[model samples]
Target: MTALGPEGHRKRLRERFLRSGLEGFHDHEVLELLLTFAIPRRDVKPAARALLERFQSLSAVLDATVQELTQVDGVGPHAALLLTLLPRLLERYHQDRWRTVTTLGSTRDAVRYLQGHLEAERKEIFCILALNSQNGLIAVERIQEGTVNRTAVFPRLVVEAALRHRATAVILAHNHPSGEPEPSAADRQLTRKLRRLLGDLDIAVHDHIILAGPRYYSFAERGEMD
Candidate 1:
């Protein structure tokens, strides 16, 4: 039997991937195969290893911004774009799947969706899911990103976003980089402020969800909502 050359080795890798999946594949191997698409006729193993070293994980490599990805040695514009876009494309697929399976109101569905949207973020991010009368998504407006303070995330701004989207209801959400879903005092205050302001406008405030790494907290589930 002839020893496999570099091209033959790459072919076998692709074939093995297509036959099965990434069930038992190493992180660098997965990344190596992925990089093959963006970079032609070059060994991607080193590039993949470098990416893992810099980002610390395959998920982080895919989630990194283009600027961050390009900082790795051998990662060019095409490779950077490819790395960042793969996770984003998967995100859109999950969102589209969530839309069919569940609306914005279901705490279960909302949690699943929000996890994908905000779980990877390293800093605080607040977004509103605007729902129509049927409880379907109308628009998802980013309220702010930073410390969750009343000043940074104004109640008026949330209501205006909902109004602009012509939404009948809204679900508030924010991430806690500390990975604890427990709402801070400012989070509680902001939720109450938005609730009252949105109430005045006759729009229902459904829930406030806090995405904290793998775990999540729902105000409605905790009976914190009035």
Candidate 2:
């Protein structure tokens, strides 16, 4: 058995990852691959292990706050920023894809669009999918972030943002960290409140989607919006 030096090891690892596309890689190897993008020249194996130990999983590490990422031994400001920005980049990609569709066809279409983009989140994020008069998606805005019990979503704020965007309709969405798609009593209450508030503004609240892991709950589909 031969041990490759740092540079040689990283070069081979990169080649292997490019060929195989993360299929059979270990957790440390995956972290190492991510770090290669962030650190470039540094030996990433130890750093990757440290990050895994600190955050438990790759998703958790990517989902961590900048402060939390900074606390890890090998993660500096630049690396933490890189990790934080990756999600935003993917979000922009999703938004771009959403823009390509001429109109939202059904409740399922709306949910499917969001599920592809937001199903893996570790924290609650409230997004407003703004639509034009023809029900075409105009923009998707992340209005707030919060813990499991509470999200800082305000009906007034949502209404104001919609008016600013000149949106005729809005679809509300939030992810459940606990991975249970069932809407809580609070979720129902919030939807009703938003519905009434938006009604006054002549902006229809199309749906309130609760994303729980792979599953999703739709207020409009279940007749909860009525």
Candidate 3:
């Protein structure tokens, strides 16, 4: 038989993909298409397969750190950079969508919006839900990013940010990649510390939420904060 040659092979595959969409494609095929956008004129099938083998799944590959991604065969600094940007782009999209909620009407609404924006993260990130005199959301600021087990959030920093935003109340939130929303002893201690510190400034610490997988635990709801 005869080789179809690179150009003809790529053209045929591209045509088929355009017609069929990604429904029947393998993981490597999907990666190949993504690579085509960055490393055009190159055969990206091998690179795609390599990435899948290394990362296990497409979502894992996309979520991997740049350094980890670069370790995959055929994934150099350029490919890693492109892969890393995808999450940031998605985060921006989520942030835009979250801004549509003008007010914090209920604890559930606040948790739903925040979990959508941050639950899938591998590391812990502390975010402040700043509110106005009327309980309207003013801004969401990411204060710190820490290891999977702990996120070091300074109460003073949170208080200062609220003061700057003219916030009358604030809801503190952070993710637990382990997906257990139950507040730990340390978590309880931190909430009490923040509440005590904020009380001096007359700024209310409304709640401290632990986001774990699809579930969330609210300190205020449990009567822990009251």
> In candidate 3, how many Å is residue 132 off?
1.7
* Model 2 clash number: 0
Segments of candidate 3 deviating more than 4 angstroms: 1-33, 41-45, 112-122, 177-180, 199-202, 212-215, 220-226
**TM-score, one value per model:** 0.77, 0.73, 0.71
Q: Best candidate, lDDT-wise?
A: 1
TM-score of 1: 0.77
Determine the C-alpha RMSD for candidate 2 after optimal superposition of all C-alphas: 3.8
* Among all candidates shown, the one with the greatest TM-score: 1
TM-score of 2: 0.73
**Which regions of candidate 2 are displaced past 4 Å?**
1-3, 38-42, 65-67, 112-123, 138-148, 159-168, 177-179, 196-204, 212-215, 221-226
lDDT of 3 by residue, 44-151 (tens): 778888898888888778888889988888788888888878877876776677768888888998897787668668899888899987889998888889998888
Query: What is candidate 3's local distance difference test score?
Result: 0.82
